[model samples]
Target chain A: MADGVAAHSERKKTGNVVEIGFTGDDAALVRALENGHPGAPAALFDRHAPHVRRMLVRLLGHDQELADLLHEVFARALKNIAQLREPARLRQWLVGVAVHTARGHIRARTRRRWLRLASDETMPEPAAPGIDPAAVEAMRCTYAVLQKLPADQRIAFALRFIAGLELKDVAEAAGVSLATIKRRLARAEKRFVALARREPPLEPWLAASTRWRDLRDDDDGGDGGEAAR
Target chain B: MTGGLQALGRVAGETAEAVAEPRAEREIAAARERLVGAREGTVALGRELATSQDQLLAYPGDDTLARARQRLLAGRRRAAGLPGFVRLAVPLAVCLLIAVAIIFGLRAREPQRAATATAVSYLVGTRAGTLGERVSAFAPRLGAAPAPELRFSDGSTVDLERASSARVTALDARGAEVDLERGAARVFVNPRRITRWTLHAGPFTVHVVGTRFRLAWDASTKRFSLQMTKGKVRVEGPTIGERQLVAGQRLDVDLSQRVSRAQTAAAKAQPSARPLAAQGASGRRHRRPVRPARQRLARTTRARRFERVEPMPAATPAPAPATATPAPAPAPARPTTLARALQHVGAGRFCQANGLLDDKALSATLAKAPAKALLALGDAARYCSAQQRARTIYLALWRRFARSPSAAAAALALARLSHTKGASALQLQQAERWLQRVSAANGASAAQQRIAAARRVELAFARRQTRRACALAREFLARWSAGSAARYVKQVAVRCKLTPERKRR
Candidate 1:
């Protein structure tokens, strides 16, 4: 994947035969889409679809339904492209749509309580042999607890903590006010902490919550990629 | 603990990427090919699905394929048949656009209904300091009998009577304020969409709600009189008290006890109380409207009812603080949780401020508080080390009330937060954007704008754009000179050696 991305080194000059990724600011691509340029939508799919897919999958852990959700997300995006008043916020908007889609998945799971959810069987493939077992178990334990949360709370928690969206963006994606998002977060955090306490595999994480700010990785500037001027 | 949460999220994200995301990519590729193929006349849209039990065993998405197939079949049938939804796609899309155009088009014209009235933007004097320079306050000398006309952007007029002068102290999206010094002033606040226009006349404050009124202060007589010939005005003063006067009514300031109506204003004031048209007013230059006419009345233009002299008044008359918690009445039933938090923030009692703000009850006001309240909340969150919350609240205040002074302050706060620790190039650019917003705000104080400009020089220095930094530092130092911002900018220039030590003799 790194090599694939490396092949496209930021489109140095205009009118070059750019690769799958448009390698230009989102605004230019949006303008092309508005003009009905055929390649622009494909470029948008290549640029944003990966991130959108990643966000939805992370929020709705190991769901086979991801493909349907993916089609719905892009179909809706294509249909509503012009509805976006600010094209510069394309990434945020796409991620918002993914989060909304994830919420729908969670709601469905909530309603289908009787369906035997194939949980642990579908966890991601194991890391290389040298990887820490505790970290692997921590990941498993984290999802185990997340599956219990209400849809709104789970979405808020995922967007706020997992995706690391700013509170404003999270509130926007969830279509709720900032205060309401905070309220939801407070409840979710409280429940998550209470649940994590019972899982011994998550003991370190539970303890780390007390000093989470101290141990977190340095913010080498979040992927807050530049917006169009 | 926050770090732990972040770690958990990283692990969760990576795991999902390793499993679900890969699956997602493969599926999307498959779906895209089918959809695009159907559109481009390549492969047939979709193949028939197997039985449900076979589908469950063979593929993860038999249902999704069925749905897509049905859609494709519908499209194919439409293409071959007389008419269908797909056949009508172009016309349907055009109709949708036309409907959207109609909705927003009507919305575009909504402001013009208010356009029938005009509001003052600038009060220019014939001999004013510099003609056409936008200044916050205008104090014009009484040169002629009519004095100089207050010329709004729309070219509407107001005149300070002879021997009278007024200084416009502040003008904001909400309203305008002018300090009436020493004599009477005839104000023609043309039917304005803005809710409030206030003139601080001597001992009294005359609040105009889109009306023509005359407020006279007899300095020698030590008396103030408010005559409302059109619309209504609420007058408040120390001894004169507060009184609401409607059209055809007059209130006289009796230094003895309270504001009292002297008499019903006679018919003489009513007939002549006509709203002054730009063309009718004498000596008024009828310049073309400064802004496009259609764009003129787009802003909310809500006449914010006079929010008493002091913002955040302590005494809210509501007896029950619990039931009415949602509304942060301009006044509060109790010493506001926000006010107390602000005090705590000032006193550096960060824990207490944080505690107060974190209360479940206080969250109600967090959403709807005025810009000033939001500022204090942002400050409290910042001091408590809740950087994310602080940034969110500051950004909200900046976005919702961009025309207020608090918004500019929020911009500066966000800029400062951005550069806190090893800020990235993108973060620095974001800071630059915030500073630009501050410098651009018409409502921001001169001091705040100057500080923001100086900070930009500092950002340049931090980015190692030494040449640019030095030049900006020199410019900043020259402009700010003795101001608080000058010292840092001067140091930056001197350190960068952009400004050399005095040439050796």
Candidate 2:
């Protein structure tokens, strides 16, 4: 009975801290952000910046330019903060902004390749220390294949699976309907698997599993609902 | 009993519901794990598959977050500071630039247009387009080394040698007319079923359907020349009138001298026969031994008769003495041995002609016989069905007077005899070699050259060398589209499926 009281007290303390930080809720935080409250940018950054950075790294595959891309995403989100339709969905809106920034960079990089002004040698190396060399090499191979995919499909794939976003969140981030995101993911999954099968380092990752095999048999129904959950 | 059964049923229903709920929850959890990876348990294989991508997770350092915050605030400030119109106009300009780039990119993928048929032929080969970007009939094109070649749609080509200038005078789908303005050009006309090509140089015009030849015209000298290496062509000009030339023949015309000469290799090899027409201007200084008065009278009569039979004018056999009296009967009462033989042959009495030509007395003087007499004696023997005798006579003519103008005719006769239907393979090979000699022999007459070229095609077809036969047939048809042998050559080309042009529908 004492242990239960202590757990309840700890939960109450966490709730109080959340209430104190934004002064009320996410709606209040969005208002403060829109009004350019002196503390609002720092508060938003502290809350969502890490999430956005993780999304970018997953999408672009450990690029050295990850920091710059992160900055671009936040800058766009703040500049277009007025365009956010729902104040309560600020985090979701920020995710959408990050997807847009990644897509733009992808398109710009493709253009540079077409113009022969840039090449594979110019791609930045993974900057994070303490990463396994094999993992880094696999990440390099994954991005190389990803670069060959269309921008919309690449973003959808990255958001849905790599970043572990729920199906609806992926749809919202890509500015597409939930059904469209599902279709994009299906195609991206097949294509990515087909391409990844060619890479020796990525082979083990795509190895068949009992759960995945069972899911594939009954994949038609409830996949979106389950993924969303 | 009924109440007890109802209670049991309720208990079973409750038990069934209890058993199904956790299983459904476990399945849902597994599905979630499949998509988002296992959050709190041992990693599933599905999540492990993305080992590389899963490892890509990174959190921004404090410094990165600070810079990003500053950048966001600064952007917000910049947006607030900007006037509304400037902000809208900047994006609009960027969109316009993108639109322009898209338009250019689409245009770049389009193919270049081909030149029109009015061009007659276009420049092609190594130096294509160097003669200007366009080609039109009647437009003189000058070319030198590294000169652009003119190519017709039908696959004909004219390679202009250095310092040469030529122009297309007329054009159509079937063939074209080219005028060699100055210098030299090597022309190749693709033989089509209905070709009608013409090449003009100065006052001379060579009509060709398909052929390969070199044509040159010198404006200052008023001279025109054509050397045929393949096929046949009809050349019309001053002095030459209309003459059919074939592969291995060369024709040179001098307007100032009112002279035109066609020759072949055999004729060129003859030192004495080379300058017969050229020496006409030098008159009587080089006149030979005077014949007896009676012999001179008989020679003049025979020359008159031979003139009617021979196509090309031959040199006066032996000039008549100035003091010789004219014969009243106009017949050779006691003609020389050669004159007697020629008369019999001209009258179709081949047996009588052969008998006289094969006489022991004639054999002693055969070494000194003129090329004309030797050629006439071979013809008489051939017509009399004296194969061995004719072969012997022709060989003698070719050997003793290898450089004589008539030697080409002798070689042609040998080729024909060897190419006969009953001849062996060895004979056919011999015939082909003879024809090659006739074609390559310098100063050979045009008629003999034509006969030799046509004979070669026949020999090749007979030997079942289909490719060579078709090639030679195409060449023959190019030069002699309306020639007597054209029908035969065209048939060969059609049979071989190597006709230069596609068959007309």
Candidate 3:
């Protein structure tokens, strides 16, 4: 039985693990990269690249754009790996990079729109295949709503709700004060809830969702019934 | 509930029907797995980058660190410039800088300051209006300039001019400390950090750690009043002689003469009774202290009394004892004013609710009732043209119940009103100011969220991004259609051209 297990593991290694160079702990990988071990960096990239790409895809709503951005993120990460003080935090470091890359893309896109001739047509919807149609539609709606928010608030909302990063992580990644992040998050959530409530078809979803309802209820109670809907 | 369940079931059925084929299910599962993998990868990367940034930021003055810092800052700037990015970036940045700064800066500075052999001395004074050229000369000496005109989150101000010769040690995230050599200096501790504003007066060291507390240290008489408006403070050393100050209490550290027994007795007496006496001396009626558990019961009673339902005259004719009183008419089934007010508000009859509140009568009634009732009334009167009345109620509430949730609510409302007619920039500024106050008092998450949303609206408006503002306005309206501020949302929507009638759905 031991022989059989060993044989199976060896075969698996031959097929998958051999494609990349050395595979071990994250620290080992970092050490390898430090030593300029061939293909060692690629192994690290293989482990983390897909996740970064997905984040970009979700944030930008375009796979091709995400793919391009993913390449840049890896290249930058690889170049700066030696400078990474804590190899253990490589994941957070990469995500932060992805967030910034996504932001740059969005900014460039917005700037381009401003430079071009004005069009009456609405934003073009992205094609997402084989996903839950409702979830995709909701995301699209959310994206449209997000475009209406100020840049700071939108980023805060994305980091907090969409990305589900902790308040501390979000603040650190964004390089703002905790208070500023709090202020932005507070406003963004309020605006998001308010906007979500205003959409006719989306109203039920907002009201029915416990999270949404709680946000509305909290805001309503605090403001002395001033803006409660 | 059954209907809701049925609707849910139908939706689920439709979703299932759409993916009936095994091939479709397999495809969906694969797609979902891929998405999950992707999401995990993104999160991992984000975490890794954040960690790396943290490590870099934590490095002890690494020159290469500046490049990483600039990258992070650039990313922040870009994110800040992106619509709806504040939610993600603001907190991340804030926590990174302030929290880390507070933790590390305090640790690094504490030992250095404590080890210093010479006390740095300078003159401290306040200047009104612009902080002029002389300001730079005076800046090093002044520990903290608390302008009375400048209201901070802590609700107290320090008059720097009052303490002319105070020495400053260090200024970090926690706040500044001063070595008080002569005369009295008053310091109000802000709530953001657990700041120990230590005033090292001769023979007396007063430490104010949190909230709106005033510490006055006098050199000649050696008298200090640590008046705690909110939160608590602990005073130690020979000057205080083992005394602690709680909220709404004042500890007078008097050393003019030998420590008198009478003053000690007065200080030891029930703290709340002093406020009661002050209230009585001002010709205001006082109510018996209801049990704290029954505090809500008192509010309900006061709310009922405000309704003014006429009591039935005593039974004139004597019938059988049990039947004569007519079962006391079940206490006349008085309708609670809060319920009535809420009803009127729900029906869009804000004017009626305002009328019921009788803003004029509130001053006398509020003096006797719990501050919460007045706060509620002020909130109700916000929509009415009675701005003065609303302002009065809020101010009174703030003064009487400064630390209460109601006070914060009133302050926020008043601040909002003050900003309404101002320019967009002014409004944004005011909103930011109010948000700071709200955040300090540990505001409700919902209130914070609304502030966030309003900020976005204000930001978009300021940038002349009318289309984006309109879109946001529409979302706000949709989410808060039944919210109390729905009308305000509607108004903003109309202004932004987000109204359904103005733009195609």
Candidate 4:
């Protein structure tokens, strides 16, 4: 379905399907989904899958299970839509659910890695097909730095920098107070920048923060899609 | 955080998505197709949940009540979306129904099991209407109508006749102590495992270990009766004092102050009272004091011999002195070999029992002995696989004492022998009849009914009666999960397979 819409977008040379947001009010859409209208969840999926998938990929870094994660996120949303009190913030609530799911996956993976330490093997870094070697090395070093950080810090840094979410949005997704996110980000940024300084491939990224921020704004429309900042 | 990976992502993030691969697209497409094709989402959720998903994504759709709540939530959402006036009317209707339900629910009180504790109100073989007292309480009162029955967890059952009531004051591994308030009850105690039981029936208290017997008490009439169908019971009361009631003997307590003679099938049979005792296969001794006998009533008319009927109240104020027929006094207990043998068998010392019965000194005693000695000898011989001896003993007991409890057991034993090689169809028919009558056998005589039931199922299966065998097998499993023939029953069930053709009722 995502491919169908991407293909359609290609034919038209227009934006992705998510850009054509469902027209109904969030409250009405939630009620319709709760009512088991069938079409409502499909519409919700169409409206949110690309956004959720994009955010998950950014946070997890080339997550191979992006498809399953997207299904899980939307299935949860569809299931719990009735419990959503603030219909106007449906997108924000969805982000909270997605953050929880991602954290669980991270924790489970950490446990698995700990259990399998006798094998003395880690998952090999995914081989990208056509990416620049320099950019790939920098990205690889970024994940390595993130891996050393606690789960909360990793999530805060991914949301604030990789996904380009504001500090308030980061707090919302992490289901924590704004103060907590601020503290996490402050602590994470100090560790992240210090760690990045040790990686030779990330030297260029630290030197051009302003230019990089500009590139991010040009690519993203302040929502989940391919983003730069 | 932003200055580190955030800056790095701002620097190199574009590369990850820039190289979006075919495999990733294919993976995403597979998930999308599954999501699209999912019809029963709850079923998919159930299947998915076995692999521990995060709590946030896990749905509680598996539980019936939870699914109901989901449907209710959807209904509520739909109702909320309706116009304000419509929503107002729905809540009012719901409130009225709730009020009505509470009102009606209070009027029809239901027996509620104490879920948190084993202190529950359990009624079986009868209903609440049959009870003379309240059925449900923090502590339940179990009662029954004529021939009231009580079932214990260890597969032993008790039946009370003529409007009986009893309270299980305490229950534990040693078995239970029942305080029978009134009337009569026969206990079909499980003898396979040793268990001590005491019955407090009015003035008389009967103590027993693993046995079958009947005890009855009437406060108004000052009448107490104790009959040991199998095993031994010691009865204690004011009138009868303390005397052990052996198998095939009836001790009755009348209005008279002194103990009377216990009724026996053979007039010349010796009176034997032996406390129940057993030695384990390892030669370990176990003993439980038996209840004393109340002595038997005088011989009545042949028509009313088995059943004891209450005399109609005298209508006239002045009545002539009752013409009581005096029976000959009972002979003193003789320490004969035959009496000792019967006592040994009743106490489960079967080797000594059979050995004594084998002696030439007791040959004359066995020839004309009562049902007590006959049943004991039959049991002793049968235990030792002396089929010919058992048949002779059981046949005599069955013929001379048809109404006695021993007769039923003897007939069933004969039924077993009748199934032997080269048996006539008439003999098999007689065995089947005995098995069926085992169902009708009341109180103490019904001890072997469970084994008889299992044997019936085994017989059906052996005869290749597929449908009948399947039905009996199913019934047997439901009735007794681990009955005597549980392995045979399970085998029959597997053989039958509950096929649609077999289940064509």
Candidate with best DockQ: 2
Candidate 2 per-residue lDDT over residues A34-103, each given as its tens digit: 6655455666776788667656766776665665777777767767888988989887888899899899
Please list all clashing residue pairs in model 1, or write none if there are none. A209-B1, A211-B1, A212-B1, A212-B2, A212-B3, A213-B3, B195-B303, B240-B259
Model 3 lDDT tens row, A1-229: 3322222222224755453245566766666667666555566666666456444544554332343566667667777788777777777778778777777766766654564422323354443343344544555566667666776777777666544456676786666787778778777767777776665545545655555577677764442121111
lDDT of 1: 0.55
**DockQ, each predicted model:** 0.04, 0.12, 0.02, 0.03
Best by lDDT: 2
Write model 4 residue lDDT over B45-159, tens digit each, in one string: 2111111111111223213223323343243321222346545755786798999999778545322211122321224455522222322211112552334466676667777
Chain B TM-score, model 4, reads: 0.29
- Per-residue CA lDDT of model 2 for B1-505, tens digit only, reads 1222233223222322222243443443343344333321112222322333333332133255565666665654222322466557657868989999998875563222112223344555634433323332222335522655787777889876645567775665557777776667789999976577888776567899899988877654445778788999998653455689999888876542234567985675665333332232121233433455455445444554443343222221222222331211211222476566666655545567678754564565356666666666676576456878878877888888775557777887787667653468999999898888775454577656765676677678668787898889888878888644455456556645632232220
**Against the unseen true structure, what C-alpha lDDT does each candidate score?**
0.55, 0.60, 0.48, 0.52
At residue B314, candidate 1 shows an lDDT of: 11
lDDT of 3 by residue, B1-505 (tens): 2232233223322223223332445443443343334332212222222222222222344232233333332332212223355446556766788988899988897756644523322233333222111211122234753422222222334443233334544333344445544433345666543344545544344566765654444443334455566776666433223356667666553332212111333454665423222222122233434444234333333333322221110001101111121221111123355445544443334456577655444545456545545555565566454667777877787677775566666656666555442236765666556544554444324543454454445446545567776777677666666442344445555556622332241
* Model 1 residue-pair collision total: 8
**Which structure among the candidates has the greatest TM-score?**
2
| Decreasing lDDT order of the candidates | 2, 1, 4, 3
Please compute and give the TM-score of the first chain of candidate 3 against the native first chain: 0.74
Per-residue accuracy of model 1 over B1-505 as CA lDDT, tens digit each:
3333333334333333433333444443343334333321001100101011111222343244344333432322212321354446646767989999999998787556444444336746654323223222223335523356676553334566545556776554434667766556677776544455677765467777688877776543335677776888887654334568888877665321112234575643553222222112222333423443223211101101111221111111111122222333432423477666655544445456667765453545555677666776676566456778778878888877876677888888888667543468899999888888886544677766776777787678668777888888787777778643565466566646722221110
Better of 1 and 3 by TM-score: 3
